[model samples]
Target chain A: MSEARLNTPISPFPSREQKQEERAARRAAVLRAAVRMFNARGFHATSLEDVATSLGISKPTIYHYLGNKDQVLLECVTIGLQQLLEAGAAARAGPGTGADRLQSFLRRYAEINMDDFGRCVIRTGEEALTPESVRRFRDLKREIDTAMRELIEEGVADGSIAPVDPRLLAFALAGALNWPARWHDPAGPQSPGELADLLVATLATGFLPR
Target chain B: MSEARLNTPISPFPSREQKQEERAARRAAVLRAAVRMFNARGFHATSLEDVATSLGISKPTIYHYLGNKDQVLLECVTIGLQQLLEAGAAARAGPGTGADRLQSFLRRYAEINMDDFGRCVIRTGEEALTPESVRRFRDLKREIDTAMRELIEEGVADGSIAPVDPRLLAFALAGALNWPARWHDPAGPQSPGELADLLVATLATGFLPR
Candidate 1:
């Protein structure tokens, strides 16, 4: 363990400032591994050793980067939520009507289903987290929900979309996007783009035969 | 463990007849406890002991009742899916216009949300099941999806609802109903009745000012 640390200081306990930078990089790497494991076996089924095994490191190495397993889960979920918000905002400038912009968001949303961030430990179970972690996740979700609601409202005001309840539509759209992670397979016939277009079409326009 | 078995007898399991019934009962009990835990902690985080302990039984007892942990998960999800299909059907009578039937289904769908069966473990993480289990769930989901699509088409044909893509509408409306599992709090401000009304209204008429 000591020799491993000496060759590659992956923790914050180095003798100098260089240690901190090394620690951050190590943490990011561990976080990446954590995302994959947690999504596969789930947060509870995954252990510190499982993570270390996947990373070709020792259990102590995990403490150096993540401190504890829970922290890794928190980081993965927090970072994912942050990315989703950014992606949603990025879609606001895309072409088409409010429905079109919303569609763009749906397309981005579909992409999340392919990998770990979309198949996250947090999104899969709220009951697994301590109240504190849940609160943190909820806070992040609330911000994104608010952003989405505003986008829906914009559609309504611009007369590009029907006047649906903004908050409801936002949540409704979110449910459709998020649901795919529970079942959609990347190797499956339906491409993400195809699913996104169909999803957006249903939400923006009603099922009423046009 | 042997002592507990004494009350039930192991002969021929002579009661092999009753044994089946008892097994069914034990299985249901395990499933109920599982739903509560899965709802609270998630399928992966919950352990076999957790299910047994909650039932005041031994771990082996659970194995006898359920083949294994995965089977329990499968059973619970299967139950949840069945309830939805049954309830959705009851909500809207068949042989009616697709729009009319779908609206009817939504009303019943909302009512089911008020029941524990509706908000069980399966709804939150059906994907947490094994591949075989997932295939079964998805196949069942497909059947329901097809029914909804047919209803959407009927609505389009009758002109009672807007003429739009029924395929897309099927998912969006279904998404709305399924989302309650993640966000709905039974003791919160809205009762199931209120929530159902809100859901039906949002899906049927939409957030549009009209």
Candidate 2:
């Protein structure tokens, strides 16, 4: 034990918590770079080397940090969905009419889709993913869809929203919110927040039962 | 003179009009096959051979009819845009109110995007095209956007729509309508027409000045 202690340097390894935090931070940084490249050159066309070059890291480093291209994409999508789901939860918890909560949730949803990670999530299609990954992606997307529908139903029940088909309404709202990721210009005059506000307001103002 | 007459066949070949018709039909068939394949397995992953095999035609036949993959994609996008432009024209001509025209136009637009050709057009992005093709595609899409904005402005001016920013409203409407191409399932419960109607009603019912 004394020989082992003598051979080992003090603070040779980080604490477990510290290592976990560092790993997470590195993972996030790699994901950010990956998402950017994926958005610019579609998910299929983008290789790990492409991502590695952009971040000034080696291809194996990306694989080391994130398992593979699929895992990288899945991670980005999970982060994006988690953010939207959290926003939905917050909106539900906030004090407001159902309509107000729905609107706020939608606005955040739209803004997120145009953000760094979210844009990648929206742009990456099932064709790029493995069968299992596709299933997971679809399930998560469906969860979001169900949440939107339920929010709309709540609004209708409470007399804040019009009596519309919740499923169809959810589709329309989600479609509009998800679309900005495809065409939104980050350098354009409209910031993500401004564009999100404009879209959500249009839906809210036009959708209310008069 | 007798020898010349004997040498010439009784019915030498098809007339110019007949030949043109045949060529056009074959071209249409090739395009149809290409669009279907592109929609099924995105544009980049799809090859001329895949389209040809699906149609039981040869790759040379696809090239003979459509020139190349880039040409195939450009043609599909052109057809999609033309259909939308035609719908806009029809809406403009068949009028109860400006809002009525806009709603009708939007419904048709959504349905077109869900159709085989239009779905391919939506799924094909700029990354897959040459710079010139991308420019042309963007120009046509911009034309559609402008038409939508004008329709909304007319509705607002005529007191059929609420006083909203027409450009923003147009984007919201177009985003909602264009998105169905990405996720719409033909095997699903909702028919394209039914889905379009529900979406249009949601927007129109909510947007009218109260």
- The prediction achieving the highest TM-score against the true structure is 2
| Each candidate's clash count | 16, 1
lDDT of each: 0.72, 0.85
lDDT tens string, model 2, B10-118?
Answer: 5667989889999999999998888888888778778999888988889999888888999999999899988988888888888587888888899999999999877
Runs with alpha carbons beyond 4 Å of true place in candidate 2: A1-13, A207-210, B1-12, B207-210
Among residues 3 or more apart in sequence or in different chains, the pairs in candidate 2 whose N, CA or C atoms overlap within 3 Å are A206-B206
C-alpha TM-score for every candidate:
0.72, 0.90
Give model 1's TM-score versus the native structure. 0.72
Q: Per-residue lDDT for B83-129 in model 1, tens only?
A: 77886666456656767788877766656655566666335454467
List the TM-score for candidate 1's chain B: 0.82
Cα error of candidate 2 at position A207, Å: 8.2
| Chain A of candidate 1 compared with the true chain A, TM-score | 0.81
| True-vs-predicted CA distance for residue A137, candidate 1, Å | 1.0
Candidate 1 chain A lowest-lDDT run of ten: A201-210
